[model samples]
Target: MDEILDVVSLVLILIGALLCLTAAIGLVRFRDVPSRLHAATKPQVLGMILICLAIALSLRSWPVVAFLVPIVLIQLATAPLSAHMVGRQAYRNGTIDRASLHVDELAGSSETPPAAGG
Candidate 1:
Protein backbone atom coordinates (compact mmCIF):
# COMPACT_ATOMS: atom_id res chain seq x y z
CA MET A 1 0.00 0.00 0.00
CA ASP A 2 1.41 3.36 -0.96
CA GLU A 3 -0.23 5.06 1.99
CA ILE A 4 1.10 2.50 4.41
CA LEU A 5 4.58 2.71 3.02
CA ASP A 6 4.48 6.48 3.13
CA VAL A 7 3.34 6.42 6.73
CA VAL A 8 6.08 3.98 7.64
CA SER A 9 8.71 6.07 5.96
CA LEU A 10 7.39 9.19 7.66
CA VAL A 11 7.46 7.48 11.01
CA LEU A 12 11.00 6.31 10.48
CA ILE A 13 11.98 9.83 9.58
CA LEU A 14 10.36 11.15 12.74
CA ILE A 15 12.01 8.51 14.86
CA GLY A 16 15.33 9.44 13.32
CA ALA A 17 14.71 13.09 14.04
CA LEU A 18 13.92 12.22 17.64
CA LEU A 19 17.13 10.27 17.87
CA CYS A 20 18.99 13.35 16.73
CA LEU A 21 17.18 15.50 19.30
CA THR A 22 18.04 13.12 22.12
CA ALA A 23 21.62 13.00 20.95
CA ALA A 24 21.80 16.77 21.15
CA ILE A 25 20.37 16.76 24.67
CA GLY A 26 22.76 14.05 25.77
CA LEU A 27 25.65 15.97 24.31
CA VAL A 28 24.74 18.98 26.41
CA ARG A 29 23.75 17.32 29.68
CA PHE A 30 26.42 14.62 29.82
CA ARG A 31 29.15 15.24 32.38
CA ASP A 32 32.25 14.16 30.48
CA VAL A 33 33.80 13.89 27.04
CA PRO A 34 33.50 10.17 26.27
CA SER A 35 29.80 10.08 26.97
CA ARG A 36 29.34 13.24 24.99
CA LEU A 37 31.13 11.72 22.05
CA HIS A 38 28.92 8.66 22.29
CA ALA A 39 25.87 10.85 22.40
CA ALA A 40 26.93 12.92 19.44
CA THR A 41 28.20 10.09 17.28
CA LYS A 42 25.95 7.05 17.52
CA PRO A 43 22.44 8.46 17.59
CA GLN A 44 23.18 11.23 15.13
CA VAL A 45 24.73 8.76 12.72
CA LEU A 46 21.72 6.48 13.05
CA GLY A 47 19.40 9.42 12.52
CA MET A 48 21.13 10.41 9.33
CA ILE A 49 21.03 6.81 8.22
CA LEU A 50 17.32 6.63 8.79
CA ILE A 51 16.99 9.86 6.92
CA CYS A 52 18.93 8.46 4.00
CA LEU A 53 16.80 5.37 3.98
CA ALA A 54 13.70 7.50 4.02
CA ILE A 55 15.01 9.44 1.04
CA ALA A 56 15.93 6.30 -0.80
CA LEU A 57 12.55 4.72 -0.25
CA SER A 58 10.79 7.91 -1.22
CA LEU A 59 12.74 8.41 -4.43
CA ARG A 60 12.62 4.75 -5.44
CA SER A 61 14.96 4.94 -8.43
CA TRP A 62 18.04 2.89 -9.07
CA PRO A 63 20.35 5.85 -9.43
CA VAL A 64 19.04 7.59 -6.34
CA VAL A 65 18.93 4.35 -4.37
CA ALA A 66 22.40 3.49 -5.54
CA PHE A 67 23.66 6.91 -4.54
CA LEU A 68 22.06 6.89 -1.09
CA VAL A 69 22.73 3.27 -0.16
CA PRO A 70 26.48 3.32 -0.10
CA ILE A 71 26.60 6.55 1.87
CA VAL A 72 24.43 4.92 4.50
CA LEU A 73 26.52 1.77 4.38
CA ILE A 74 29.75 3.66 4.73
CA GLN A 75 28.41 5.70 7.63
CA LEU A 76 26.98 2.63 9.35
CA ALA A 77 30.30 0.92 8.85
CA THR A 78 32.60 3.74 9.87
CA ALA A 79 30.79 5.69 12.57
CA PRO A 80 31.59 3.24 15.33
CA LEU A 81 35.19 3.01 14.27
CA SER A 82 35.42 6.78 14.31
CA ALA A 83 33.77 6.94 17.70
CA HIS A 84 36.02 4.25 19.12
CA MET A 85 39.16 5.92 17.89
CA VAL A 86 38.05 9.31 19.16
CA GLY A 87 36.91 7.91 22.50
CA ARG A 88 40.16 6.01 22.92
CA GLN A 89 42.10 9.10 22.04
CA ALA A 90 40.06 11.02 24.57
CA TYR A 91 40.71 8.38 27.20
CA ARG A 92 44.40 8.36 26.43
CA ASN A 93 44.52 12.12 26.51
CA GLY A 94 42.67 12.05 29.85
CA THR A 95 39.59 13.96 28.76
CA ILE A 96 37.30 11.28 30.17
CA ASP A 97 36.83 10.73 33.87
CA ARG A 98 36.59 7.18 35.22
CA ALA A 99 34.21 8.35 37.90
CA SER A 100 31.81 9.56 35.24
CA LEU A 101 32.28 6.54 33.03
CA HIS A 102 29.66 3.93 33.88
CA VAL A 103 30.82 1.48 31.23
CA ASP A 104 34.40 1.05 30.19
CA GLU A 105 34.31 -1.51 27.40
CA LEU A 106 37.52 -0.86 25.60
CA ALA A 107 40.16 -3.57 25.92
CA GLY A 108 43.50 -2.85 27.62
CA SER A 109 42.30 0.48 28.90
CA SER A 110 44.13 1.88 31.89
CA GLU A 111 42.79 0.55 35.16
CA THR A 112 42.45 4.12 36.19
CA PRO A 113 42.39 6.20 33.07
CA PRO A 114 44.61 9.10 33.86
CA ALA A 115 43.03 12.49 34.47
CA ALA A 116 43.34 15.25 31.89
CA GLY A 117 46.98 15.81 32.79
CA GLY A 118 47.99 13.02 35.10
Candidate 2:
Protein backbone atom coordinates (compact mmCIF):
# COMPACT_ATOMS: atom_id res chain seq x y z
CA MET A 1 0.00 0.00 0.00
CA ASP A 2 2.75 2.39 0.88
CA GLU A 3 4.62 1.59 -2.33
CA ILE A 4 1.47 2.08 -4.33
CA LEU A 5 0.89 5.40 -2.65
CA ASP A 6 4.47 6.41 -3.44
CA VAL A 7 4.00 5.61 -7.09
CA VAL A 8 0.79 7.61 -7.15
CA SER A 9 2.53 10.50 -5.47
CA LEU A 10 5.36 10.38 -7.99
CA VAL A 11 2.84 10.37 -10.81
CA LEU A 12 1.08 13.37 -9.34
CA ILE A 13 4.35 15.23 -9.01
CA LEU A 14 5.22 14.42 -12.61
CA ILE A 15 1.82 15.61 -13.75
CA GLY A 16 2.18 18.78 -11.71
CA ALA A 17 5.62 19.42 -13.21
CA LEU A 18 4.20 18.86 -16.67
CA LEU A 19 1.47 21.40 -15.92
CA CYS A 20 4.10 23.92 -14.86
CA LEU A 21 5.99 23.29 -18.08
CA THR A 22 2.80 23.87 -20.03
CA ALA A 23 2.24 27.13 -18.15
CA ALA A 24 5.79 28.22 -19.02
CA ILE A 25 5.14 27.48 -22.65
CA GLY A 26 1.86 29.33 -22.45
CA LEU A 27 3.60 32.40 -21.08
CA VAL A 28 5.33 32.63 -24.47
CA ARG A 29 2.43 31.53 -26.64
CA PHE A 30 -0.40 33.51 -25.09
CA ARG A 31 -0.76 36.97 -26.54
CA ASP A 32 -2.57 38.71 -23.70
CA VAL A 33 -2.80 39.20 -19.97
CA PRO A 34 -5.96 37.19 -19.29
CA SER A 35 -4.86 34.25 -21.36
CA ARG A 36 -1.49 34.17 -19.68
CA LEU A 37 -3.17 34.54 -16.32
CA HIS A 38 -5.39 31.58 -17.06
CA ALA A 39 -2.37 29.49 -17.94
CA ALA A 40 -0.35 30.49 -14.88
CA THR A 41 -2.93 30.19 -12.11
CA LYS A 42 -4.10 26.61 -12.46
CA PRO A 43 -0.66 25.11 -12.85
CA GLN A 44 0.75 27.04 -9.92
CA VAL A 45 -2.01 25.92 -7.57
CA LEU A 46 -1.89 22.35 -8.79
CA GLY A 47 1.88 22.21 -8.61
CA MET A 48 1.90 23.28 -5.00
CA ILE A 49 -0.82 20.80 -4.16
CA LEU A 50 1.08 17.96 -5.81
CA ILE A 51 4.29 18.93 -4.08
CA CYS A 52 2.58 18.96 -0.70
CA LEU A 53 0.88 15.69 -1.43
CA ALA A 54 4.23 14.22 -2.38
CA ILE A 55 5.73 15.36 0.88
CA ALA A 56 2.82 13.95 2.81
CA LEU A 57 3.10 10.65 1.02
CA SER A 58 6.85 10.38 1.53
CA LEU A 59 6.28 10.75 5.25
CA ARG A 60 3.82 7.85 5.10
CA SER A 61 1.85 9.37 7.89
CA TRP A 62 -1.15 11.58 8.68
CA PRO A 63 0.47 14.27 10.83
CA VAL A 64 2.35 15.81 7.92
CA VAL A 65 -0.78 15.82 5.81
CA ALA A 66 -2.62 17.71 8.51
CA PHE A 67 0.00 20.44 8.34
CA LEU A 68 -0.23 20.47 4.57
CA VAL A 69 -4.01 20.82 4.50
CA PRO A 70 -4.11 24.47 5.55
CA ILE A 71 -1.40 25.40 3.09
CA VAL A 72 -3.25 23.82 0.22
CA LEU A 73 -6.50 25.30 1.42
CA ILE A 74 -5.07 28.78 1.51
CA GLN A 75 -3.52 28.49 -1.94
CA LEU A 76 -6.60 26.92 -3.46
CA ALA A 77 -8.77 29.73 -2.22
CA THR A 78 -6.51 32.68 -2.92
CA ALA A 79 -4.56 31.84 -6.06
CA PRO A 80 -7.36 32.08 -8.60
CA LEU A 81 -8.88 35.11 -6.91
CA SER A 82 -5.57 36.93 -7.04
CA ALA A 83 -5.02 35.95 -10.65
CA HIS A 84 -8.47 37.17 -11.61
CA MET A 85 -7.99 40.46 -9.79
CA VAL A 86 -4.68 41.03 -11.56
CA GLY A 87 -6.12 40.15 -14.93
CA ARG A 88 -9.06 42.44 -14.32
CA GLN A 89 -6.77 45.30 -13.38
CA ALA A 90 -4.65 44.73 -16.46
CA TYR A 91 -7.70 44.65 -18.66
CA ARG A 92 -9.03 47.78 -17.11
CA ASN A 93 -5.69 49.49 -17.62
CA GLY A 94 -5.54 48.34 -21.28
CA THR A 95 -2.34 46.44 -20.79
CA ILE A 96 -3.69 43.37 -22.58
CA ASP A 97 -3.89 43.07 -26.36
CA ARG A 98 -7.31 43.43 -27.90
CA ALA A 99 -6.62 40.99 -30.71
CA SER A 100 -5.89 38.14 -28.34
CA LEU A 101 -9.31 38.34 -26.76
CA HIS A 102 -12.47 37.01 -28.36
CA VAL A 103 -14.70 38.75 -25.87
CA ASP A 104 -14.00 41.48 -23.36
CA GLU A 105 -16.79 42.65 -21.09
CA LEU A 106 -15.06 45.93 -20.53
CA ALA A 107 -14.04 46.38 -24.14
CA GLY A 108 -14.64 49.77 -25.72
CA SER A 109 -15.61 51.02 -22.29
CA SER A 110 -12.07 51.84 -21.33
CA GLU A 111 -11.43 55.21 -19.80
CA THR A 112 -10.36 57.86 -22.24
CA PRO A 113 -6.82 59.16 -22.01
CA PRO A 114 -6.55 62.66 -20.65
CA ALA A 115 -5.58 65.37 -23.13
CA ALA A 116 -2.38 67.37 -22.57
CA GLY A 117 -4.20 70.67 -23.02
CA GLY A 118 -2.61 73.61 -21.29
Candidate 3:
Protein backbone atom coordinates (compact mmCIF):
# COMPACT_ATOMS: atom_id res chain seq x y z
CA MET A 1 0.00 0.00 0.00
CA ASP A 2 2.80 2.38 0.88
CA GLU A 3 4.66 1.56 -2.30
CA ILE A 4 1.53 2.01 -4.34
CA LEU A 5 0.93 5.39 -2.79
CA ASP A 6 4.53 6.41 -3.50
CA VAL A 7 4.30 5.38 -7.14
CA VAL A 8 1.08 7.28 -7.63
CA SER A 9 2.52 10.32 -5.95
CA LEU A 10 5.60 10.23 -8.15
CA VAL A 11 3.52 9.88 -11.29
CA LEU A 12 1.27 12.75 -10.31
CA ILE A 13 4.21 15.00 -9.57
CA LEU A 14 5.93 14.13 -12.86
CA ILE A 15 2.76 14.71 -14.85
CA GLY A 16 2.22 18.03 -13.11
CA ALA A 17 5.78 19.10 -13.80
CA LEU A 18 5.43 18.11 -17.44
CA LEU A 19 2.21 20.12 -17.71
CA CYS A 20 3.94 23.13 -16.21
CA LEU A 21 6.76 22.74 -18.70
CA THR A 22 4.28 22.55 -21.57
CA ALA A 23 2.55 25.69 -20.32
CA ALA A 24 5.89 27.52 -20.21
CA ILE A 25 6.71 26.43 -23.74
CA GLY A 26 3.30 27.46 -24.96
CA LEU A 27 3.67 30.85 -23.31
CA VAL A 28 6.92 31.45 -25.15
CA ARG A 29 5.93 29.89 -28.48
CA PHE A 30 2.41 31.25 -28.98
CA ARG A 31 2.29 34.40 -31.08
CA ASP A 32 -0.68 36.40 -29.82
CA VAL A 33 -2.15 37.37 -26.44
CA PRO A 34 -5.28 35.19 -26.57
CA SER A 35 -3.46 32.06 -27.58
CA ARG A 36 -0.75 32.79 -25.04
CA LEU A 37 -3.40 33.35 -22.40
CA HIS A 38 -4.97 30.00 -23.19
CA ALA A 39 -1.61 28.31 -23.01
CA ALA A 40 -0.59 30.04 -19.83
CA THR A 41 -3.76 29.55 -17.85
CA LYS A 42 -5.20 26.17 -18.85
CA PRO A 43 -2.24 23.90 -18.40
CA GLN A 44 -0.74 25.90 -15.58
CA VAL A 45 -3.89 25.61 -13.51
CA LEU A 46 -4.12 21.89 -14.14
CA GLY A 47 -0.47 21.54 -13.36
CA MET A 48 -0.89 23.31 -10.05
CA ILE A 49 -3.86 21.14 -9.16
CA LEU A 50 -1.96 18.01 -10.03
CA ILE A 51 1.03 19.13 -8.02
CA CYS A 52 -1.16 19.88 -5.05
CA LEU A 53 -2.88 16.53 -5.36
CA ALA A 54 0.48 14.87 -5.41
CA ILE A 55 1.42 16.71 -2.25
CA ALA A 56 -1.81 15.63 -0.61
CA LEU A 57 -1.26 12.06 -1.66
CA SER A 58 2.25 12.03 -0.33
CA LEU A 59 1.23 13.45 3.01
CA ARG A 60 -1.99 11.47 3.34
CA SER A 61 -3.04 13.59 6.23
CA TRP A 62 -6.28 15.37 7.01
CA PRO A 63 -4.44 18.54 7.91
CA VAL A 64 -2.67 18.65 4.57
CA VAL A 65 -5.97 18.20 2.79
CA ALA A 66 -7.53 20.98 4.84
CA PHE A 67 -4.87 23.32 3.54
CA LEU A 68 -4.75 21.98 -0.03
CA VAL A 69 -8.51 22.03 -0.55
CA PRO A 70 -8.67 25.78 -0.18
CA ILE A 71 -5.58 26.25 -2.31
CA VAL A 72 -7.00 24.20 -5.16
CA LEU A 73 -10.34 25.95 -4.83
CA ILE A 74 -8.80 29.38 -4.92
CA GLN A 75 -6.65 28.44 -7.87
CA LEU A 76 -9.58 27.03 -9.77
CA ALA A 77 -11.60 30.15 -9.11
CA THR A 78 -8.91 32.66 -9.97
CA ALA A 79 -7.19 31.13 -13.03
CA PRO A 80 -10.16 31.42 -15.37
CA LEU A 81 -11.20 34.81 -14.08
CA SER A 82 -7.71 36.16 -14.54
CA ALA A 83 -7.44 34.58 -17.98
CA HIS A 84 -10.78 36.07 -19.03
CA MET A 85 -9.85 39.52 -17.84
CA VAL A 86 -6.51 39.36 -19.58
CA GLY A 87 -8.02 38.04 -22.81
CA ARG A 88 -10.76 40.68 -22.74
CA GLN A 89 -8.21 43.36 -22.14
CA ALA A 90 -6.07 42.04 -24.92
CA TYR A 91 -9.01 42.08 -27.31
CA ARG A 92 -10.05 45.58 -26.25
CA ASN A 93 -6.47 46.82 -26.53
CA GLY A 94 -6.16 45.39 -30.05
CA THR A 95 -3.33 43.07 -29.07
CA ILE A 96 -5.23 39.86 -29.90
CA ASP A 97 -5.02 38.50 -33.44
CA ARG A 98 -8.43 39.14 -34.93
CA ALA A 99 -7.78 36.79 -37.80
CA SER A 100 -7.35 33.92 -35.40
CA LEU A 101 -10.82 34.38 -33.94
CA HIS A 102 -13.51 32.32 -35.65
CA VAL A 103 -16.37 34.49 -34.44
CA ASP A 104 -15.84 37.69 -32.57
CA GLU A 105 -18.93 38.61 -30.56
CA LEU A 106 -17.19 41.58 -29.05
CA ALA A 107 -16.12 42.93 -32.37
CA GLY A 108 -19.43 44.51 -33.33
CA SER A 109 -20.16 45.63 -29.80
CA SER A 110 -16.83 47.34 -29.38
CA GLU A 111 -17.34 49.74 -32.27
CA THR A 112 -18.45 53.15 -31.08
CA PRO A 113 -21.77 54.50 -32.35
CA PRO A 114 -21.45 57.43 -34.75
CA ALA A 115 -22.10 60.74 -33.10
CA ALA A 116 -25.56 62.14 -33.90
CA GLY A 117 -24.13 65.57 -34.74
CA GLY A 118 -21.65 64.08 -37.22
Candidate 4:
Protein backbone atom coordinates (compact mmCIF):
# COMPACT_ATOMS: atom_id res chain seq x y z
CA MET A 1 0.00 0.00 0.00
CA ASP A 2 2.79 2.42 0.79
CA GLU A 3 4.59 1.66 -2.46
CA ILE A 4 1.40 2.08 -4.42
CA LEU A 5 0.75 5.43 -2.82
CA ASP A 6 4.28 6.55 -3.66
CA VAL A 7 3.87 5.57 -7.30
CA VAL A 8 0.55 7.37 -7.58
CA SER A 9 2.03 10.47 -6.05
CA LEU A 10 4.98 10.41 -8.46
CA VAL A 11 2.69 9.99 -11.44
CA LEU A 12 0.48 12.83 -10.31
CA ILE A 13 3.50 15.10 -9.94
CA LEU A 14 4.76 14.26 -13.42
CA ILE A 15 1.36 14.87 -15.00
CA GLY A 16 1.06 18.16 -13.16
CA ALA A 17 4.47 19.24 -14.43
CA LEU A 18 3.48 18.37 -17.98
CA LEU A 19 0.28 20.39 -17.72
CA CYS A 20 2.24 23.42 -16.45
CA LEU A 21 4.65 23.08 -19.36
CA THR A 22 1.75 22.99 -21.83
CA ALA A 23 0.29 26.13 -20.27
CA ALA A 24 3.60 27.91 -20.78
CA ILE A 25 3.76 26.77 -24.38
CA GLY A 26 0.20 27.89 -25.03
CA LEU A 27 0.93 31.34 -23.65
CA VAL A 28 3.81 31.69 -26.11
CA ARG A 29 2.15 30.13 -29.15
CA PHE A 30 -1.39 31.53 -28.97
CA ARG A 31 -1.97 34.65 -31.02
CA ASP A 32 -4.76 36.38 -29.05
CA VAL A 33 -5.61 37.49 -25.53
CA PRO A 34 -8.60 35.20 -25.00
CA SER A 35 -6.67 32.18 -26.12
CA ARG A 36 -3.74 33.19 -23.95
CA LEU A 37 -6.10 33.68 -21.03
CA HIS A 38 -7.59 30.22 -21.55
CA ALA A 39 -4.15 28.71 -21.63
CA ALA A 40 -2.99 30.65 -18.63
CA THR A 41 -5.90 29.82 -16.37
CA LYS A 42 -7.43 26.41 -17.12
CA PRO A 43 -4.46 24.10 -17.28
CA GLN A 44 -2.46 26.17 -14.86
CA VAL A 45 -5.13 25.87 -12.19
CA LEU A 46 -5.57 22.14 -12.80
CA GLY A 47 -1.81 21.67 -12.72
CA MET A 48 -1.59 23.49 -9.43
CA ILE A 49 -4.35 21.35 -7.96
CA LEU A 50 -2.70 18.16 -9.12
CA ILE A 51 0.66 19.20 -7.77
CA CYS A 52 -0.83 20.11 -4.44
CA LEU A 53 -2.70 16.82 -4.28
CA ALA A 54 0.51 14.95 -4.97
CA ILE A 55 2.26 16.86 -2.22
CA ALA A 56 -0.48 16.12 0.24
CA LEU A 57 -0.55 12.47 -0.74
CA SER A 58 3.21 12.09 -0.49
CA LEU A 59 3.37 13.78 2.86
CA ARG A 60 0.38 11.83 4.18
CA SER A 61 -0.20 14.24 7.02
CA TRP A 62 -3.23 16.21 8.16
CA PRO A 63 -1.22 19.40 8.51
CA VAL A 64 0.00 19.17 4.92
CA VAL A 65 -3.52 18.52 3.62
CA ALA A 66 -4.82 21.41 5.67
CA PHE A 67 -2.22 23.72 4.14
CA LEU A 68 -2.83 22.55 0.56
CA VAL A 69 -6.64 22.76 0.77
CA PRO A 70 -6.80 26.53 1.02
CA ILE A 71 -4.19 26.99 -1.67
CA VAL A 72 -6.24 24.89 -4.09
CA LEU A 73 -9.48 26.57 -3.10
CA ILE A 74 -8.04 30.04 -3.54
CA GLN A 75 -6.65 29.11 -6.93
CA LEU A 76 -9.97 27.64 -8.03
CA ALA A 77 -11.75 30.76 -6.94
CA THR A 78 -9.41 33.36 -8.44
CA ALA A 79 -8.17 31.89 -11.73
CA PRO A 80 -11.43 32.01 -13.68
CA LEU A 81 -12.38 35.38 -12.24
CA SER A 82 -9.06 36.91 -13.20
CA ALA A 83 -9.19 35.31 -16.66
CA HIS A 84 -12.66 36.71 -17.29
CA MET A 85 -11.56 40.18 -16.23
CA VAL A 86 -8.51 40.08 -18.46
CA GLY A 87 -10.48 38.82 -21.44
CA ARG A 88 -13.19 41.41 -20.92
CA GLN A 89 -10.59 44.15 -20.69
CA ALA A 90 -8.94 42.90 -23.84
CA TYR A 91 -12.27 42.91 -25.68
CA ARG A 92 -13.15 46.39 -24.49
CA ASN A 93 -9.71 47.69 -25.44
CA GLY A 94 -10.00 46.12 -28.95
CA THR A 95 -6.88 44.07 -28.30
CA ILE A 96 -8.68 40.81 -29.03
CA ASP A 97 -9.56 39.88 -32.59
CA ARG A 98 -13.35 40.06 -32.94
CA ALA A 99 -13.41 37.64 -35.84
CA SER A 100 -12.10 34.79 -33.72
CA LEU A 101 -15.20 34.72 -31.50
CA HIS A 102 -18.10 32.64 -32.78
CA VAL A 103 -20.70 34.21 -30.51
CA ASP A 104 -20.29 37.73 -29.20
CA GLU A 105 -22.82 38.50 -26.49
CA LEU A 106 -21.41 41.95 -25.80
CA ALA A 107 -21.70 43.23 -29.33
CA GLY A 108 -24.76 45.37 -28.76
CA SER A 109 -23.64 46.86 -25.47
CA SER A 110 -21.99 50.28 -25.44
CA GLU A 111 -18.46 50.50 -24.12
CA THR A 112 -19.24 53.53 -22.00
CA PRO A 113 -22.37 55.02 -20.45
CA PRO A 114 -23.83 58.44 -21.13
CA ALA A 115 -23.01 61.35 -18.80
CA ALA A 116 -25.49 61.68 -15.90
CA GLY A 117 -25.51 65.49 -15.76
CA GLY A 118 -26.42 65.85 -19.44
Specify the highest-lDDT model's number: 4
Go through the candidates in order and give the C-alpha RMSD of each one to the true structure.
4.9, 4.8, 4.4, 2.9
Arranged by lDDT with the best first, the candidates are: 4, 3, 1, 2
What overall lDDT goes with each candidate model? 0.82, 0.82, 0.89, 0.90
lDDT of 1: 0.82
Q: Which stretches of candidate 1 lie over 4 Å from their true place?
A: 99-118
Could you tally the backbone clashes for each prediction?
0, 0, 0, 0
Candidate 2 displacement at residue 62 in angstroms: 2.2
TM-score for each of the candidates: 0.75, 0.76, 0.89, 0.91
Model 4 spans with C-alpha error above 4 angstroms? 113-118
Model 2 alpha-carbon drift over 4 Å, by segment: 99-103, 107-118
Q: How many clashes (backbone atoms < 3 Å, residues ≥3 apart in a chain or on different chains) does model 2 have? A: 0
Candidate 4: tens digits of C-alpha lDDT, residues 25-109: 9999998998899899989989888999999889999999999999999999999999998887788789988887899988986
Q: Which residue pairs in candidate 2 collide?
A: none
Q: What is residue 73's positional error in candidate 4, in angstroms?
A: 0.5
Q: Compared with the true structure, what per-residue lDDT tens digits does model 2 show for residues 32-69?
A: 78778888888877887888888888787787888999
